[model samples]
Target chain A: MHFVDRVRQRLDDAELQHNLKRTRGRNAASRAAAVAAFPDFDAVRARATEIRARVLRDLDLWLEAFEAKATESGATVLWARDGEHACELIIDIARRHGVRTVVKSKSMVSEEAGLNAALEAADIRPVETDLGEYILQINDNEPPSHIIMPVIHKSKEQVSALFARVHGTAPKTDIEALTHEARAVLRPQFLGADMGLSGGNFLIAETGSVAIVTNEGNGRLCTTLPRVHVALTGIEKVIPTLEDLSTLLRVLPRSATGQAITNYVSLLTGPRHAGDPDGPEHMYFVLVDGGRADLVGSDFEDMLRCIRCGACMNHCPVYQTIGGHAYGWVYPGPMGSVLTPLYQGLDKALDLPQAATLCNQCSVVCPVSIPLPELMRRLREKQMEQGLRPWRERLATRLWAWAAARPALYAWGARIAVRYLRWLADGRDRIQVMGLAPGWTAQRDFPAPAGATFRDLYARRRQGRA
Target chain B: MSTRDDILGRLRRQLGRTGSGLAEARRRIRDEIDTPRSGPRPSPGDDPERFIGRARAMLSTVDGCATMDEVPAKVAGWLRAQGLTTRLVIAPAFAGLDWSGAGCEVRAGAAGPHDAVGLTGCFRAIAETGTLMLRSGADMPPVNSLLPDTHIAVVPRTCIVPDMETAWTHARAEWRHWPRAVNLVSGPSRTADIEQTIVLGAHGPYRVHLIIVG
Candidate 1:
């Protein structure tokens, strides 16, 4: 019910509809152009997929290597089995260090764990440093619609309104001015915060380092100025070696924002070493395993190979229409459809698995070549297996199966249904309304049947030939 | 079991691997890390001109310095040309550079917010993306390039790498034990978070000037 309500709200919001149209189109085209410009995209993509596949095969091994190396490099490695544990670890770290404020870069892992609220509950101010994230943070903690561009759901005027109301300045329509407003506000937060929290883009198992990719320099500041830096990432983010980072980076920025490389790609090992004047003195990595470990060696294991590029959603027709908030979770789009069902239980997100049109656009654009549509289909099958799909849908499917098993019955039912649908059309080619399946025709016209079943046509043609 | 053990245990169980060969797999992982594999990299041409072109593409100003002795004067001229202040926060590596010759007073240490320009030397100049790979240390604080409104890096031509893979290989051979942070900055900070429009200088340096020493 909540998901349906959110979908209705997003669909009815004209500004959001316009923005999603522009956002999805521009994002998809930019990614295509970026991929087109790269001459060796196919080969590099192959290498990237190979690297991810290797990690998936031995995820535990890669994680162990990373943990050991991180610890050796003076980073305290913490493991969490769930989101609650992850939040608790970070809060505990803040309490131990007497950290009153945390300057955080945009981290999806932290978002999943609800780290900001936890930090607030612990009496530590958590500042969102990314421009988009800052906008969402100040405006009642709006969840990001798109992972890459969190505020893409809102229009420019909306952001201007929010900024003017919050900063007590005149509403500035220009993005440059609005961006500068955020820069001015967050600079002091970066300079004064006691702890810098970031999400690891890739955890290099060989060197015990965490790589963070960002266009803005907030990631650098969050890790550099603060006395303590804490990187929270999923356990599946680990890679075997630093060389693999180069392979992933080759496609990551290009696929995400159409940049050959983001403005900053920082591979931070442990804390500042001896004789280092700046950078965090204490570095910690809390590797969260919330449902990720369960994904290993499962049917949906390939979902773990996702680089969080958001390309799947950028190209998803369903997402383009309904937007991410309609999915009702942290991750959205095709990847989120699979992830939400698996991570948050299928019964809760049954509509998500069926949200796609199976256009295969998502898989084609995926940097790591994750078969997202197939994954969503698998989620649907899982829902059916668990009896989580709607009872009517299940019954309809079973009745169809029973009819399909009997050739004569199937032909008879199909012929009658086709005639009835043709009559419903009343000589028109398109039916605007259908009594049996009104939901299908609610938004778009359904094509009228040609008044003949496949079996009838086949048998008549065969008899005439004989 | 402790949280760590429980997670590792679940992961191992899902992976269907027993603890019998943990030591062997560890050795293999270490070997894989040590023996570097060069993945496919875009052909970032190996030349100072190519590096300069790429750097410019990333929105950085690249000027050539014929010798290390002329670095300070060049920095001053560039700053004046850009209508910036002559006061600088220089990294410890540039302590001996003659700032007086350029008519500028400079402080040698970590950069501060009030500092208008931060000057430092780069570990490597990546030609692939026109990026500066900065290794943080006492002599070269990462904030020198971050905190200031303007960041100027003097890179030697010998320090240029064709791609990121080579940068790491070079870093491994050079740093031995890696520095705390290795930041690869392409250009000025920009964000497209608002309406997907890129606005430069979001929270870091508004300008990135690269002075290459041949």
Candidate 2:
């Protein structure tokens, strides 16, 4: 079975179709309300985009400056070129600290680097304290299908089952009961963990601070309770100053989840101060490049502007249909389609960029306004240039392009095809199956072409001139 | 030591190649000698109340709670209503509050499993971001705000500030004498991973109740 098909099967078993539909509806309504509520949302987003663009334009300089300042602040900074190196550095830190167990909040970069698996292989256990992440961990599952909501694929029934299995209790379908059960299970992990790990949403170069946003107090506890704290983040997650961070904080939650702000926004500069009563004795920031530096000065540079809001996915029809895991990466949906091929290389994930319908919804709803469809097109073009396009799809696109280049032939072909399609419909006005178009017709019936082709009608209308 | 020198030498070489090392050193020296610009002059349009209102709106979307008077009782009431037990750990900041009249055993110290709820007073609330600040101290153990089934925080009305800038100013002043972990909480623990269903209380407190003490 295909990757998407496997995800579909899981989603079906989990009975998440209704929940996804409801979430999409709620998200749409809330986003609309948030936009309406904050009339300055567009201005804020534009300002944020400018700020990010400026930062990326001079990223090398800013990064070096940040490193220098952070070093001065008594924080150790490690730069990783890719996921493997990132995982290695984090594991090395854990080893040095003799960390047996690690409590963590949500960090997409860590997920992207597959940190947990690496830590486990190194004989270190990493515990996820974020509610959604904790559920995913309990199930021994993959990184969340969504950026903001990791376990958006499971239903209450499935959660109840997972909780029951983990806690040795009978399954309870109530949402409240399931939440309580998870709380009881995770309480012990928080206290016993030796170190805390997190991801920074923004890194302020001005103050050498790592800013993390969370709706849970776990982010705070995870950073403060342990003797060692490690922050793993992508290089692009930096901003020039606190004022710039403020601008982003204003727009991030509103655009992502229709919230004004997340619950907890913690800023950590370095390890505990001399007089501080509680906090980690040691602090480390792992700045992972992971193909981001390559994006600088490139056509796809805007992709780095993402704040991991999952807004584009929420608004995407294809994502709404298939859900996240289909994209076969940490990220999924429209944003995932554009990002996967870029980060993983087009050769490795050729099918991803072609997944979009080019409806342009992702671009419109993006807080940074990334032009995702255009980027996908660029990826497709690159794939074709590399001769990696599937033969069938290549042949189809080639034929369409050829026909389109020859208007006379195209006009005749369109008329003939329309007539043939109408005949095939047999008065039903829709075709249940379309040869060579199974990807489309498999899900829904295609409407038969109208009586007269546009070319034919236009020609007839211009008969007087002829 | 050799590896460290090698890395440093490599960085130094890279800096020399870019011709930015000398410039950067000069810039750092200048920054050390120069004073930072004063806070952006407050505009006439900047209404603290209006800003607070906007910030509150943002906070509420993330499940931030606000209340008035009798914070402990209100918090206890909320927990009991959620079917949580009365056993709780009270922060030293609330030591003077009479919880005996509320009919609950409020122990003052770090939290335990028997403690279903934890209550504490926030040092300040930033209305610009709708965040409640808690600094780690003898009275406020970071775990008391977390690691419990439910968390109840008390924020006095006057402690609320308009934005992060103001909050930073307040924090800087407070941390001048003693620096510790400053926690800014905006709402309860929530996750949207399960089919985008917003589930509250995943790993931390399942529910958070805020009592606004005027």
Candidate 3:
């Protein structure tokens, strides 16, 4: 099946209907709570934007400071220009350590680099310990559907079936019981894993530290319990100081899940200290550039300011319709729409930039005020300019744009199209299908024109008045 | 060139930086970080009682004592009231305290997997987000606060700060050599990942009880 058809089928699933309703309800509550929690919500968002802009403006200095400080604090820092380089560094670390099993908390960079596959290729087992990520991995290792809430697409009954199938356990109906089952299954993995890997939320330059904000506290477990701990993050995550981190933290949880603070925010500067009895022995920080540097001066430069809050997707109408999987990559939704095309190259993601309806909802709710719709439009223009669009779509757009340039020709063309459509309606008043645009007409009927076009109607009114 | 040099060079080229501009930016960032400016914070009222109230509002239970000696009894009383077991694992920092009189069996070390309750002392408590700041050290490891289902953190009244900014100020000055880990825990571990339904006790303490010693 084609990718678009598969997405439609998934969207039509009854289970997805239940899941999206739950997601919509939760997002509404979170948006309300976020607004209520921060009385100066706009001011906080503006401050966060300024801080991010400053960091991006002076990216080199902050990254250098972070690298220096982290190294000073006894961390081994590595750099990766692309995903393959990053995966190689991580796989090398695992191989050197003779790591049989590695546990990872949710790291989109790791997903972007396909770290699990690389590790598996080298005879290493990569285990996902986060409950949502664990669920995704156990079910054929599908990429996370949502950035923040990975399993928001799965219903309780589906999860029950998966657990019963995977663990040979009794089906669980209670959410708490289901959670307990996951914890029971994952605790051993956490204890037995040779190394732990995680993604850094904010890389603090001043203290040479990296912060991971999580509600489950698995971030701590992953970074602490294992012998070797590694954090894979993009270079854009670097901020100047802890003070700046506090500013971002104030808005991050509030904007993301409508919480005053997440349950745990861990700041790890290095591996275990000299006298420390428990924690990781060696810490590694792999800074991945991964095509973000290419966007440093582009029109879509603001895309780098994203903090991965999933707010844009939560607020986007198109994303709400098609869901994250349809976006076809590690990142999804409005931010993903711009990012996937840029990171993976435009040729590989022709349909993603066009997934939007030019709705300003994503940008309005964006914490950093990233002009997501504007970026998507720019990508669409780029795609058109480069002839990346499908032949039919390109021809149709060219024909419309050509006709639109001349007012008289556009009017005549519209009048003729209306007459033809009306005739095709056969007194039914609505067209159920069209040969030219069957996909558009498949879901909903198109209204047939009753008589003359708007221009013609206006001309008649003017003549009657005279 | 090495990958590091290539990445840095690419970033510099993208930013349109010349030779001297990089050094100037580095110097400016150094100055910026050295003189840390406090960010905007919520007005949770300027009182210790307000801190306690806010902490409680985050679903963390709080109790206060007139002195450090009274902390054990309060801990024992809370455990009894909640109908929980009296077995507890206290951090070594609180080892000298007499917990035997409180009708509870307590030990001082890291929390094991089977341990239901663990106690540790917080470096500071921020009233802004109702957060407890725990720095990892020999006296109190991270597992004490993390592994147990119920974590009882003892926060001295002097350590309660108005916001996160002030708390960081104190942390930077006090710990010249920063610890390996600094955990800012707001409440018990919770996740909304399951169909966006909030569930507590997701791999961290299900309950966090704060004892404020004056």
Task: Name the top DockQ candidate.
Answer: 1
**Top TM-score hit:** 1
**TM-score of the second chain of model 1 compared to its true counterpart:** 0.95
lDDT of 2 by residue, B158-204 (tens): 77766665665666566653334556676566655554556776556
Can you write out model 3's per-residue Cα lDDT over B1-214, one digit (the tens) per residue?
A: 9988888888888899987887788788889989987567676677577778777877899888989889889999999999998899999999888899988899888888889899999998998778999999989889999888899999998998988888889988898789999999988887766776678888788899999888
Docking class of 3: medium
Model 3: clashing residue pairs?
A: none
Which portions of model 1 show Cα errors greater than 4 Å? A425-429, A450-452, A455-466, B19-24, B44-46
Expressed between 0 and 1, the share of native interface contacts present in candidate 2 is: 0.40
Q: CA lDDT, every prediction? A: 0.89, 0.74, 0.87
- lDDT tens string, model 3, A297-357? 7788899999999888888777776777888899888999999989999998888888888
Please list the residue runs of candidate 2 whose C-alpha ends up more than 4 Å from where it truly belongs after superposition. A4-19, A396-440, A445-466, B1-124, B135-144, B147-158, B169-180, B190-214
Candidate 1: residue pairs that collide: none
Error of 1 at B157 (Å): 1.5
What residue runs in model 3 are displaced by over 4 Å at the alpha carbon? Answer: A400-441, A444-466
Count backbone clashes in candidate 2: 12
TM-score of B-chain for each predicted structure, in order: 0.95, 0.74, 0.95
A441 Cα displacement, candidate 2 (Å): 3.3
**Candidate 1 per-residue C-alpha lDDT over A1-466 given as tens digits, one digit per residue, 9 for 90 to 100:** 5777888898898988988876668888888898898899999999999999888887777887888889999999999888889999999999999999999999998889999998898899999999889999999888888888898888889999999999999998998999998899899888899999999899998889999999899999999899999999999999988789989998999898888889999999998888888888899999998899888999989899999999898888888999888999999999998899888888888888888899999999898989988898888888888888779989999999999999989988898899889888999999999989899899899999876887888889999999
Prediction RMSDs, each to the true structure: 1.8, 5.6, 2.9
Task: Give the CA lDDT, 0 to 100, for residue B139 in model 2.
Answer: 76
Give the DockQ (C-alpha) for candidate 3: 0.77
